[model samples]
Target chain A: MNAFIIADNIISPLGFTSSENFDELKKMHTGVKRLEKSTLSNEPVCAAVIDTNKLDAAFQKLSAKQEYTRLEKMVILSINDCLNQNKNIDISNKKTLFIFSSTKGNVDLLDASLASKFDKKRIYLWETANVIAKHFNNPNQALTVSNACISGVLAIILAKRLLEENKYDTIIVSGADILTHFVVSGFQSFKAISNEVAKPYDVKRDGISLGEGCGTVVVSNNKSLAVTLSASSRAESRDEGQASAIIISGGASSNDANHISGPSRTGDGLLLAIEKTLKESNVKASEVNYISGHGTATLYNDDMESLAITDAQLASVPMNSLKSYFGHTLGAAGVIESIIGIHSMRENTLIGTYNFNELGVTKPINIIKNTQKQEVNNCLKTAAGFGGCNAAVFFQKHR
Target chain B: MVNGTEVYSDSSLPSADFIKSAYKHFQLNYPKFYKMDHLCKLAMVASDLLLKHNPITKKYASEDIAIIIANSASSLEIDTEHQNTISDKNNYFPSPAVFVYTLANILIGEIAIRNSIKGENTFFIFDKFDADFMGSYNNSLLSSNKATCCISGWVEFYENEYEAFLYLVEKEKNELNIEHTSEQLNKLYINQI
Candidate 1:
C-alpha cells in the first residue's frame, strides 16, 4: 500500500508552479529580498513574500465567484494547478480527501484592520479549509493539520496512512501559510528571523528568513493515475526510456520531549524518526542518495540536523536545504521541498544549498553547495519544528 | 474531570481557579504546570487524569504510543495573547514564551515531555469534534502497527471555555469493554459534554 505522488504544484515567491520553482533553483535564483518597512514589521526585515498582484491576477483566471484570503488563494491555485495536471483525479468524489496544512491560517484576521474583509470565522483554520474544499465542491469535510512547521510533512504522512487503509483513492495535501504581522512579530520576538538571505549549514548563518507560499501534492495508491510533471519533463528532455514511479514509501513523526521551542540537543528524536521511516520504506541508509533537509539556517537547527544525520549514519549522503531559495515557508516547506526532491529523483539532479559556503555543524555531513547532476533514486526529507516535533519521510523512485 | 466524569468541579470558581483547584486536588507535582497556557494546562490536566490510574508508559514502549488531538480555535487564546504582544506598535514586546504556545501542538509536546512518550504526534483542527474521523484514524494507527496505543480525542480551549475529552485506544480491551467505534466515541464524548 504505497502512496505515489500523482501531481504537484508550488505557489511561492520563486514561482507559481513546481517546475517554475525548480527552474529558479537550477539557476540559483533566490526569492528572498530585503524589505524597508513592510506592514508585517516596523523595522526592516528580510523575507520571501509572494507578490499579491500576481497571485490575485492568476487566481482571477480561475473565475472564482467569491473573494479569498491571500493564503486561501495560494492554496486554491496550487491545488487547482495540481489537479489540472492530473485530470484523472475526481476532486468532488467521496473517495478523494482534501487535507489542508498550515501553522497559522488567516492569522492576519487577528488584526482588526484586516479582519473586516471576511467573516470572523475565517480566522479559524478549519473554516478556511472548508472554504478551500467548498471551492472545489468537495463534499467531504477537509481535514486541517496545524502542527507548527511540520504540518506539511505530517499532512502527507496522514494522506499516505489513509491511502494505505484503502479509505480514499486520492488525497490532496495543500500546505500554505502567509506572512502576517502576527507571525513575523512573533518570530522577531524569538530572534529567529534572519535579516539577510538564509545560509543553511553555514558558519555565518544567523536565523531563518521567513517566507509565505502554498504547495499542493496529490498522492494516490495507484501509481498509474498520472506521471509526475517533473518525471514527464525528464522523459521529454532526456532520452530516458521509462520514468520511475515516484512513491512515498514511508513516513514517521516524533517529538523531542526535550524542549518546546528548541530542537533536541542529542538529535535522538529526529534520528528515531529517520530510522523508522527508512525501516518502513524498506530502504537502507546507503540507498538514500539525497537528503532534503529542513535547514532553517538557525544556528541550533542546522547543528541539530547535522547531528541527526550523522547519528542516522547518513552523513555522507548529499543534502541541501531549499530555505535559501524560498526562505522558510514553515508549513509549506516540507511539501514543496519534498516535491523538489521527487523532481530531483526523476531528473537525476540535486539542487544545492543556495547560500551555504562552509560546514558549521559539529558533525560532518555532506551538504550540497551547488546544483549538480547525479543519480538520485531515494530522497529522505526531514523536518524539525517548534513543539519539539520532528518528521522524516522518504520519496523513492520505483522502476 | 476524567472522561466527562467530574473529579472536581465548582460553579462558583472561575475557569482558571477551577483548573488550579483540580491540579491541587490531583496533587500534580509538575511545577512546569504553572508556565503552560490555558490550552496546555487543560490538556496536561486531562491527560494526567486519564493516564493516572492506567499509566501507558509502564504498559508500552515510549515509541509505541501516539497522541492525535483535534480542536477548533487552535490556540487562538494564546494566539490572541501573542498577537497583543506585537499588535501594539507603541509597546511591542513579544516574548518567546508566549509566542511558542501559539501553536496548538505545543500542548502535545507538553504531554510528551511530561510522560517522555515520544512517538507519532499530530495536532488537527476541526470545526467541531468529528468522532468518526478520530475513531477511524486512531483505529487505523493501531491496526497498522504504527502505534500499539494512541492517546487521542478533542481538546479545545478558547476564550476561557475549555473541554478535553481524551481516551486511550489499545488493542487489548480494558474493563470498560467498549469497542473502538465512532458511535461509541460520540457517546462517550457527548457524555463528557
Candidate 2:
C-alpha cells in the first residue's frame, strides 16, 4: 500500500525542473525580489513571480493549440515535465487518476478584462481542472482540491489513501497558483506580504513574501512504482549502485477551530496533525531525519511552528523552511516544498533556511541556517493555512 | 432539510431570503452567521439541519469525525466581492474578512468551529456533485479507521443560486438503514426526497 514517488517537476521563478530549482537552492539563491511596480499590486511589493516570456516559451514547446490561463499553463507544463521523467505510467489508463490542488485556479479570470477573453466557466477551479485533464485526453474527470494552502499535501494524502484502497495504480498530483491582483491585494490588506525577501524564523522577519509557482508529482503503489533518483544522486550512489524508492508513508489533516484567519496560539491543532501523522507512519519522533516546515515568515505562523516542533519532541531535528527561497507559493508550496524535500533526501543535502539570522520564536529548535550535506533518510513536511487548517505528511526512503 | 426532504420551510422564497428565514425559523443563535458570506451561510444552515437530527459529535470523539464537502462555484460569491474591492485601484479597499472567505475551505472551518469537530477536514471542487468519488472516499475514511463518522456532501452558493445536501456517513447503520453507494447518493441528491 506504499505510495511511492515515481517522478516530479517544479515550475517556479527559480527554475522549471525540480533539479534546476534544487541546484539553485544548493547555491543559496532565492527567487523573491522587490518588485518596484507590478500589476499584482498598486504599491511596491516583494514576490517570486515566474517570467511571462519564459513560461510562454516553455508552454510553446508543448505545442498546445488551445488557449489556457496562466495557472493552467503552469499546471500543464508541470505535469507534462513530470510525465516526461518517467514514461512507464500511462495517464490515459483508467487506473490512473488526476488530482489538481490549488487555492485559486484561474481566479484571475474574475477580472472583466480577462473574463471576456476566456470562457467565464474557466474561473471555476473544477472547470480549470477539467481543461488540464482534457489536455492529456484522460477520460476520468480530474478531482480538484482547493483547501487553501494545504491543498497540495492533502491531495497527495488523498492519492495515498486511494492507492492503499487499491483504487488507482497511478495518481498525478499537480498544485499551482499564479500571482494576481486578487491575491496580492488580499494579502496586502492583511499586511501579510513582506516588504523584502521573507526571513523565516528570523527575529526581524516582518511578513511573508507571496510567490507563484506550480509543482507536480507522480505517486503510485509498488505495482507501478520504480526507484528513480536525480542523475547526480544516482552517480553519487554508484558505490552501492542501489536505488531507493521514496514513499508517501503517512499523513493527517486537522483544524485549529480557533479562528478562521489566525493560527492557534498554543499550536495544539498543528501538533495534533503532526502527532497523528507520526503515529500513522509508525515512525517515532526521534527517527525523523529532517523537517520541512510551513514557515510563512508571518509573526504568528513561524511562532506556532516553533511551538509545534518543540512540543512534538522534534526540536533537535535539522529543520529548514524553503519559503525564503521560493516565497510562499500557497497551493504550490506543499507540493513544491515536498519535492524539494525529496531532492534533499536523495542528494543527502539539507538546504538552509535562507535569510535566517537569529531565533525569533519562543521555543528552541534546530534550524539549518546554511546548505550542508547530511544523511537524510526520512523527512516530515508540515503546513498550516487560513481557515485554521493544518496538515502533516511523512516521506521515507525505502531501499 | 433532512436527507433532501424539507423538514419545515418554504423552498419558493428567494435564495437569500430563504436562508435568512431558515436561520430565524431554526432559531440559530450563532452571531457569526450574520457576518459570513453566502457560501458559508448556506453550509451553516445545511449542516445545522443535518446535525439537528443526528448529533454525531456527541457520539464520536472530535478527532474521529471528518468533513468532506464539495461544490461547483467554490466561494466565488465572496470572491467576486473581494475582487471588486481591489478592482478599482483608485478606491481599493480589501478587508481581511472578505479576503479570508475567498478560500472555499473557510466554510469547512466554520462548520468545524461550530461543532468543535477537529478531525480530517477537506474541501473539494467539482463541476457537479460527484457522488461516486464522495461515497467511495468517505467509505475509505471509515474503513481505514481515519474517522468513525463523517459529515459529507455538496454545498454550492454562487450569484443568487444555491443548494446544499449534506448527510452524515457513519459505520453503524442508522434508523434509515440506507446503504452508502453512488447510486443511492444520485437518488437522494436528484429527487431530494
Candidate 3:
C-alpha cells in the first residue's frame, strides 16, 4: 500500500511548470522581489504574483466557459501542468479523486458577493468544487480541505489514504492561495508580514513576505523515482504533542496552542512534532541530513523553529527556509517546500538560507549560509501558520 | 477496555447554564471549556462522552492521544461573522482573534491542550456523513499504530443547530459487548432509544 507521487506541478515566484521552476532553482534564482501589484498592499516587498492576463489566456485555451477566481486559476494551471507531464494517462476511466487544499477557497468571491447579496448556493463549498471540476472535466469525487497551513499536506495525506484503500486509482492533490486584501490585511493586522524580503534563520530577520502561488501532484499506487509517502501523522496531544511533532517516519502536524497568531516561546509543540516524525520514520535526530523550515522570517517563527530543531537534537542538520526565496505562500508552503526538499535531495545539494547574515535566535542549529553540495539522504520540511498550526514532513532519497 | 457515557445540554436551561452543565458532566472547569468557541463546545461534549473522563490534566502528556474530527460547515458561522465585520468600508480590518477561529481544526488543538493528550490530529470535511470514509480513516490510523487512542467522530454546527457524536477507538484483543460495525454506530445515533 505504498502511495507514490508520480508527477508534480507548481506555479510560484520562480516559474509556471515544475521543470521551469526546477531550472530556476538550479540556477539559484528566486521569484521574490518588491511588490508591484495595485490590488495588494503598497508594501515594496512581495513574491510571485501571477499575471492575470496570462493566466486568463491559458484558462481560455482550456475552455471558454470556465470562470475562475485568482485562487482557482492557480489550481487549474498547476493541475494542467501535472496532467500535461503524464500525457499518456487516461483520466476518464480512472476514479480520480480531487483533494483541494486551501485556507481561502474563492473566499474573495465571498468578499465580492458581500457588497451585493449573492445566493448562498452560489458561494458555498460545493459551488467552489464544482467550478474546478467543470473546468478540468473531472467527473470523479471532489473534496476541499481547509487546515490553515497544513491544508495542502493534509490533502496529500488524505489522497494517499484514498489510494491505499483502493477508493481511487489517481488522486490529484492541489493547493492554491492568492494575495487578496482580505488575506493581506488579516496578516498585516497580526503584524506578521515583513517590510523586506523574508530573511529566514537570520539574526536581522524582521518578518515574513506575504506571497501567492499554487502546487499540485498526481499520486497513485504506482512507484517511480519519487519517494513513496510512507506515513502522515498529526499531533493529538495536549501539551508535549501540541506541535504534532514531526515524529512520523514521514510527516506530522503539531500546533502550539499558546497563541492564536504567534508561536510558543518554548517551541514545545514544534519540538514534539519533529521528535514524533523522527521516531515514527525510524530516523534518528543525528541521521537527518537537512531541514526545510517554515522560515517565515517573522521574529517569532524563525526563532521558534530554530529552538524546536535544537531541542529535538537536530541542531547540526543543515537547514534553510525557502520563504527567503518565495516568501510565505501559506497553505501552499507544505507541498511547495516538499517539492523543493525532493529536488534538493535529488541534487545532493542544499539551498542556502537566503538573507541570513547572523544568528538571531539562540539555537544550536546550523543554518546553511550558502548553497552547499552535500549528500542529503534524509530531509525534513516544516511549516507553521495561524492558529499555531505546525507541520513537518520527512523525505528520503529513493534508493 | 469498553466504556460509554453521554451528556446533553438541558433544553430548559439558559444557554450559559447548558454550557456549564455540559462542562460539569465532563468534570472540566467551566472557565476551561468556556475559553473555547461554539464548535469546540460541540466537540468537547462528544469527546467527554467517548473518553468517559477528563484527559486534559497536566499529569498526562499530550502526545499519547489523537483526535480525528470530521465536519460539514467547517467554521462557516465564524467565517460569516468575520466577513460581515470586514464588509463595511469603515471597519475593513478583521479581528485576528476571530480570524484564527476560522480554521476548523482549532477545536482539535483546543481539546488537545485542555486534555494534555497530544497525539496526531486531523480535521476532515465531507459534504455529508459518509460511514465508509469514517470507518476507513479510523481503520487506517489504528492499523498504522499512529495513535494508541483516538477521539474520532463528526461534529456539525451552523446557526443554532449543533450535533456531535464521538467514539474512543483503539485496537483490542477481547471482544466487547457493544457492536463495532458502522451499522451499529449508525443505529446508536438514529435510535436514541
Model-by-model DockQ, in order: 0.87, 0.85, 0.36
Please list the C-alpha lDDT of all candidates, in the order they appear: 0.90, 0.89, 0.68
Tens digit of lDDT per residue, candidate 1, span A19-119?
89988998889999999978878989999999989999999999999989989999999999988887888999999999999999899888878889999
Model 2, range A1-399, lDDT digits (tens) per residue? 678898999999999999899999999999998999999888899999999999999999998989988999999999998788887878998988999999988988899888998987888998898999899988888999999999988988888988887868899999999999899989988988888899999999999998999999998885334654433357755324433678998999998888899999999889999999999999999899999999999999999999999999999999999998988899999999999999888878899899999988879889999999878888999999998899999999885
Docking class of 2: high
TM-score of chain A of each: 0.98, 0.97, 0.87
Local error of candidate 3 at A238, Å? 48
Please give me the DockQ of candidate 2 compared with the native complex: 0.85
Candidate 3 per-residue lDDT, tens place, B1-193, comes to 0243333546887544565577676675546566666787767666665555534333334565667777777777677777776667676767777776777888777766555565667777767655666666777776776665667777777776676767666666324455456786676555541
Model 2 pairs whose backbones collide: none
Off by over 4 Å in 3: A26-29, A41-48, A93-95, A113-119, A122-127, A130-134, A137-139, A224-249, A255-260, B1-28, B32-36, B48-61, B173-176, B189-193
Residue B43, model 1: Cα distance from true site in angstroms: 0.6
Worst 10 residues of 1 chain A by lDDT: A230-239
Candidate 3: tens digits of C-alpha lDDT, residues A251-346: 676667666556879888878777767776778888889998888787777788878888888888788888877667777877777777765655
DockQ-wise, the better of 2 and 3 is 2
